[model samples]
Target: MILTADVLENAFVRLEPFEPSMRAEVRSALDCDPDSWGGMVAAAYGPHFDGWWTAAMAAMCAGSRIPWAVRRQSDGAVIGTTSLYEIRPEHRRCEVGSTFYRPETRGGPVNPACKRLLLDHAFAAGAVRVEIITDTLNPASQAAIRKLGARDEGVLARHKITWTGRIRDTAQFAILDLDWPKVRQLLDDRIAGFSES
Candidate 1:
């Protein structure tokens, strides 16, 4: 199974391959909240934005990660970004992480729509496990992952040093291939409910 980036979309959001031209727009969207970067391992706003952008592009070019610009389908506006990284085809696993969106896009169908597309793509490409890891300090992120039907796999203590030099505990979650059917249904139902409202 060769895992590669492809355009993934649903009714609410579209995940397009991240490109150099999108750097400015994506950075502007991310700059809306400096506090949003607090729980993130790497800074993505202000002075740190350039470094983050460079590394992301390098990873994509090196085939180590597949990043996407998250666009709202209604306006074709780039609201944020996400990625499938730490991919290991031999192990049939990959991580859905590095996800962030503008403040307005949170707590709506945008997230579930994006995850549904990413999960569906990974599973279809023969992935046995898809993991979503987050900073333990960020309960909002952990809760959002749980809402997607991911099983909490506990914390990884001293997981990694954050950009601010803080040792972060990572909250791990996973949805195995065996669990996909139920998770898929849950996500679909949730997105459908959003549309209904």
Candidate 2:
């Protein structure tokens, strides 16, 4: 396995290694964009997002070889990030999370392109089932995962305690290797449609 922080690249994005220097980019991405995500979801406040920052830096320093800061291949703007956390080669499973994007890149090609890149890599790495979880209250994220054709794998009740000291239920989603063909095909169609100008 290619373990030890590395960049994920493709035609659309050049995800860099997340570092302390990029803290501003990460903080800005989380802090000012959503403004409560149209009040449809509780916007991820900046202070609470430190967890993501810590994890990313740790991953870069000693964790694994896969965490990356997502950037436009064209401009290299630090727009967002994602990582393959809790990787278990024995189980061939890993959790893909800690994703955030700048407002400008949202509802655009960044997400699908990023996911397309990550999922493609994950499967190639022998990950039979890749899982992602989001807060149940975060309908927008849930909808996005569903749109990716991930199967609803039930909710993990009181899955975690938020920074606000409230218990949060997490909605889980997964796509297995067997499902990749269809999922990939679906994503291909969506991305193609996204690029049809």
Candidate 3:
């Protein structure tokens, strides 16, 4: 279960290891829609952006998380960020989370394309199970996760304390290795549909 931060990409998006040089681009992409971070436990917009960026960079530097700057393939623009964290090789499990995308990239091929690449990489690295968790208040996120073929595993009460000191409940979803083949096909078909359109 060796999960390394290698470049993972597809036709629509490329997941490159997050670097300090990408700070401005990433910040600009996130600033495009401050409202988008409403449901996020950590602040990634406006006044909180600097702190969030600092902590994120620190985490990446410590090897506590494998973070990627999600780049749009067409123009190679940094549009978002995502990570593979809470990695446990002993359990052969990890989480694909801390994901965010510019509002413009939502509701299209970007998500599926990104997920397909991430999931493929995780499983290839010997992940027996991968979890995608979201704030319970974020129905849109929950819906999107469900659309990825992840099974709802209920909510964790008072799961985390947000940056604003509010207790947040988290909805848990998971896709097991046994479910990978189906999930993979579903993602591929969805991405293909976008191209077909």
Candidate 4:
């Protein structure tokens, strides 16, 4: 169920699946920007992520509904991670979240290019709707989703008190396949505008 045709190419980045050899690189990338989500993720899974990324990567490699991976390029350095989770075949919907990128990759073509790859893949996989949810406080991520043309569905107030004991507000966004032609065109324009030298 390789939801996507394969890796997507753009002027600055490529979104592809996590591979076995990427273990160390992924660990390295996740290690940076510790103040962001380091304690939440890396410390919990760092030592054995080689197997974890491998398993997760294998699932995506198997074309499972939740195919996911750490983002990188020909350089094989992991800069971010995202996944198509909570898939509902009957509903023709799935979520695109659990995404994080190193600070270095921010405000670069990397983020948009990665999103373009995911969105195209989801729509191309016959999904009627692809959604993304971001913590309300994470303005950067929220803005990025909006820039991609996703409509604000709603806010899940106090969605779930995290283990850290913080009540999180989630801002949801979605792009239906019906909007792909236009959204894709919009992304193309944005990517072009940003990549211009």
* Candidate 1 lDDT, 1-197, residue by residue in tens: 56788999889998988887888888987787888888788989889889998998899888778989899999999999999998888899999988889998899888999999999999999999999999998999989999999999999999988898989999999999999999999999999999999
Model 4 residue 102 CA deviation in Å:
1.4
Candidate 4, residues 34-131, lDDT tens digits: the string is 45653222221445445546666666656553433445554766676667765767787888765767887788777777778788877877899988
| Sequence-dependent TM-score of model 1 | 0.97
TM-score of each: 0.97, 0.83, 0.95, 0.80
lDDT of each: 0.91, 0.74, 0.89, 0.69
- Model 3, range 1-197, lDDT digits (tens) per residue? 88888999888999988788888888887776766676678978777879988988787777667888899999998898898888888999989988888888899888899899999999998999999999999899999999999999999999988777889999999999999999999999999999898
What lDDT score is found at residue 55 in candidate 4? 61
Winning candidate number (TM-score): 1
RMSD of 3: 1.2
Q: Distance from true position, residue 59, model 1, in Å?
A: 0.8
Clashes of 1: 0
Ranking by lDDT: 1, 3, 2, 4
Q: List the residue pairs that clash in candidate 1.
A: none
> Following a full C-alpha superposition, what root-mean-square deviation does model 4 have from the true structure?
3.4
Ranking by TM-score: 1, 3, 2, 4
lDDT tens per residue, model 2, 1-197: 33345567766777776777877876666676644433221334466567656755676565553567788877867777677776777778877776777767878778878888788888887789889888888888899999999999999998877655668889999999999999999888887887785
